[model samples]
Target: MTARRSMIRRAAAVAAAATAAVVLAACGGGNDSSAGHEGHGKSPSPSASAPASASASAKQGEHNAADVSFAKGMIPHHRQAVEMAELAETRAGSAEVKKLAAEIKKAQGPEIKTLSGWLTSWGEAVPTEEESGEHAGHSMSGMMTPEEMDKLQKSSGKAFDTAFLQMMVKHHEGAIEMAKTEQSNGAYRPARDMARAIITSQSAEIERMNKLFGKS
Candidate 1:
């Protein structure tokens, strides 16, 4: 859970700049881009909401199945990850935890917007559901539960750090799985590249997390 949140938050942080001008609703007859929703401070979108829309869009072009699935599946997955990263920043006592949280938030923010835009342009449902679990649980790569998140948020100091690394490692692995699935099954150029990037980067992070967790 922690890892997933971190990833999404990171996505947002990166895309923060690009997301300012959103043209939602125009995607598939949805509500239209409200620009972070009137005063609520741009709530983080779960992965479930964006995929359906993305899938519809991906189908239109030379884009392959992997691209659609990657966007559809990953958008909700990234939402959970961003949430987790925020929890860490607020609850964690360690500087490392804070820094990591900042990184996650930075990276995920824009990805969320980018994927949403993709889905909108594609004219799909956005892969989101009314209930959060629509994601089919963390069974997919880079996903975590609210309960698991509670565990991470409750820890502190060394324990918090350890749990964070362990959880993030698993989270990154999940992302890798999703990415691999994209690479094998997806067809879009940019989407495929993103998948490969996730594979290359998270693999290293996974190793680092392991070493950190193993430390006595």
Candidate 2:
């Protein structure tokens, strides 16, 4: 019962994260459909508008320059982790597995927002890296491949629990790698701190997951 509860909680958090991110991104982070125009008036002459546009563009460009590297790199990075968490929520039967998923979702969701906030402040598009390819079965730390996700999607009971634990272990490790990279190369201090914290917590979680899966 506890395990089920935990898994449910984690699932909720992951769903919330995905939902919130899409909402926030839609609202402001990525596309500014209104950027070039103002209320149904004749378009400002480029001669007059050029400087404003250029300035806005320049600010956005700088924001991208300053923040893009973090958002671009982190978005995909967090996405994979979220995917892994989602898998754990559905398949994991153990309280530990569910708890891990919740932790992952909680952590990454905020990080996603932090990065999104950066882009919003900078007035730039959300980095586009995560959208480039199919995420269906791509593997990371312990993230299942397509086959693996397929298996989990089909399995039930203990089978799901074991697989979830094993896969999440690997997925978390992958996340650790990305986090380390950000810690070293990410432009923003907060982003870098997020990377470091992910590494620390996930590394600890990896050990726990290993024990749960008897991989220890």
Q: RMSD for each model, in Å, please? A: 33.9, 34.9
lDDT (Cα atoms) of all candidates against the true structure: 0.71, 0.69
lDDT of 2 by residue, 32-111 (tens): 65553444456657698788878877553242243466565566667666766787676666777778778888888878
Provide the lDDT at 125 for model 2: 73
158-192 per-residue lDDT for model 1 (tens digits) = 77777777777777788889989888887777788
Predicted structure 1: lDDT: 0.71
TM-score of 1: 0.64
Angstrom error at residue 38, model 1: 70
Worst 10 residues of 1 by lDDT: 23-32
Task: Give all TM-scores, in the order shown.
Answer: 0.64, 0.57
Best of the candidates, lDDT: 1
